[model samples]
Target chain A: MSRRRPSTRTVLLAGLAVTVVLAGVVSFYASGHPDGLEYVAHSLGFGDSAGPHVSDNSPLSGYGVKGVHNARLSGGLAGIIGVLLVGALATALLYAVRRRAPRD
Target chain B: MHVPDGFLTAQTSLATAAVAAVGVGIALRGARRELDDRTAPLAGLVAVFVFAAQMLNFPVGAGTSGHLLGGALAAVLVGPFTATLCISVVLLVQAIAFADGGLTALGTNVTLMALVGVWVGYGMFRVARAVLPKRTASVPIAAAFGAALSVPAAAATFALLFAAGGAVPIATGKLLTAMVGWHVLIGLGEAAITFLAVGAIVATRPDLVYGAQDLRPDHADLEIRDGVVV
Candidate 1:
């Protein structure tokens, strides 16, 4: 029997599905500790130098909805939204920059 | 690493911003060649995956966590130029939507993660691939090596930028050591992720993996007998 490789559409959709699960569900279990730079900064006595982000008041600030009280839902929704946004932006950018089709 | 605002002075931020701008401009041009009919969809998928993977910050040690920088993974999945653009898009979305990285520090973040991470990772991967056995199996191993070093390279670049325009006067040496040390641990995670991701993609769809393109089965099937055409 011939081994049939998955089509590009199938692979892309599968990859997207995996991304949704990772961002929406698995992200909830991520560690809450400071990352490498943040930890090192505080350890070295410069952590306080960080200024508040200008977008701190945005709805998606801190990776959660502004009014959403449920931590899990908020973070999951935010993650999924972020995934979509990244996908949209990246696809658009690639379309603009990628080589044009001959028929066009 | 996300370099927040107030960490570096305005001058430093502006300088880095200029650098990021130029780097991204060049990447835009280069990506035009790397991205075409077949790879554009894959590139978008990579961008989204990087955004998602970045959210899952696994702990390294001592209460410090590390997430996927995704330079090597992206470089292996897509080409280096497209990888840089993909990461820049992820950073742009994160800053605007999630307010994760500071607006003023956007340039620094792009410089460190997008430019430095992608180039250094791709460069290292090329070096490792050249030395390792020329086979599809070597792609993931080279990608892992590239991923492992990319994290600390980004960290060290941050340290250099901080020393140049840090808001507070701290021991640069100590900061560098700490940053590199922690990132070394994080790089291990990066290596693991790159290894698994690249290995899976290479195993399933070797044609789609940019890094493994040269090691395609047809290339290995070449029989140049007596330096003459078969």
Candidate 2:
């Protein structure tokens, strides 16, 4: 008998669910501590060497929305927007590459 | 680690940016060979998933936190070349949209996370798989080891770059030791996430996993017997 496989739709949907939960809901609870690099920089006294970001004025700077006051809501909105934007860009790039790939 | 602007001398950043450009050009060609109609969308999803995952910073210790770089995870899910593209996309979005990384430092971040991290992790995965038994279980095990090593490897790469042209003068030895030490701890988190994610995917949809593709035939047969192939 032929074996069945999980449909692409199912797998994609599952992935979407995980991404939504992690980026949209759970991201607010992430630790606020400096990451490994930033921690090292601060400890080593070179943290001051870092310059200002070019996009410092971006509405979504620092992963939080500019106008939103509620920390959770701002972060969650920014994360969701990031996921969607990245998802769309990656999909377009991959599909474009696939279209150009050699047919075999 | 995302290196911000002015962290490295302009000369070093420019040189690394050139290298990053060449690497990304190669990756674009390689990804074309790897992506297909079906897998292409999955690759996109992998990028999305990685971006989402990176938002959650899990604390390591001593006021230090780390997030998933997702290089190994993406390499195992998709092929390495596509993994490079996935991470490059993430970094691009983070830098441009979120302003999380420096715009001028985009190339450095891509080189460290996308190129070095993915290649080292994928290479280690290949080596571990070769030495280990040719079973489905070996996939996640090898991936865990690969993911674990990749973090420090990237940290070391950064150390080398800093040594070459850090904006500020610091002891290279001290930086290397500190970076490698902290990153080793971060590597544990990388391994755990890679192992769990790969294991979960292999359990439900092994065929979708690029690194586990070799074991698909046997896995499919076993799933058929268990009445869970679907």
Candidate 3:
């Protein structure tokens, strides 16, 4: 018997679900240690030279919503927002490019 | 690796910014060839998936964590041109909205992760594919090898940039060693993730996989019999 291929919608929705879960819930459990670059910078004595981000005032700075005391909720909300915004922007850009692509 | 503000000299930052802009412009044009209406949205979804995956920083070693750059994975799923754009979009969003990466350093991040990562990973994937068997299984294995190398390669590039024009003076030799060493560990995680993700996709939806496109059967009725058309 031949297997039925998943529709694009099904694939997309599945991807969305995975993104939501990973970004929203599992992210909170990520290792809190400094990343590779940051660790090296600190050990090498240049980590102190790092300056503040220009968008530090953004409501979603540091992947946490501003003024939300609940860490989990804030981070989860920020993650969800990020996934949605990225999805939207990517879709728009890709669609625009597709429109511009020469038809074969 | 996301370079923070005040890390590199203004001149270096500006130079990288110019390079990144040119790279993105080229990618924008090239991505047009890779994307069609049906697959355009797949590029977007790839970005979203990468962004989310980047958030989960798994520990590599020595109190240091690493996350998926998604370059190899994206290039295998989508074409490299579209993968570059996808990663660029992710970095841009992270910088502008989340402030995860520095605004001034956006160009550096784009160059390192989007351009360098994608090209190196994709190139390595192609090289590996050339040597490996042409079976569909080879796609993910090649992707894994590529992803493993791309992390350390990006780290080396950052070290080179820093050597050229770091805002603060440091020993370049030691810094390079440390950066490359740590990233080599991180590259293992990159390989694992890339392998699993690409393997799963190739198994379930070979049609959606860009790198494995050649592995797909041409058509049901177009079989060759004994090297002769029948």
Instruction: Report the number of the highest-TM-score candidate.
Output: 1
At residue A40, candidate 3 shows an lDDT of 96
List residue ranges in candidate 1 displaced over 4 A. B218-230
Q: Compose the digit string of candidate 1's lDDT tens values, residues B117-198.
A: 9989999999999999988899999999999999999999999999999998878889889999999999999999999988
Clashing pairs for model 1 are none
Per-candidate iRMS values, in order, are 1.7, 1.7, 1.7
- Looking at model 2 chain A, report the run of 10 residues with the lowest lDDT sum: A94-103
lDDT string, candidate 3, B45-162, tens digits: 8999999999989998779999999998999899999999999999999999998877889999999999888999999999999999998889999999999999999999999999
Candidate with better TM-score, 1 vs 2: 1
Q: Mark the regions of model 3 whose C-alpha exceeds 4 Å error after superposition.
A: A99-104, B221-230
Candidate with better DockQ, 2 vs 3: 3
* Model 1 per-residue lDDT tens digits across residues A1-104: 13567888888888899999999999999999999998998889999999988888889989898788999999999999999899999999998999977894
Could you give the candidate ranking by TM-score, starting with the highest? 1, 3, 2
For model 2, the stretches where C-alpha displacement exceeds 4 angstroms are A1-5, A99-104, B218-230
1 or 3, greater by TM-score: 1
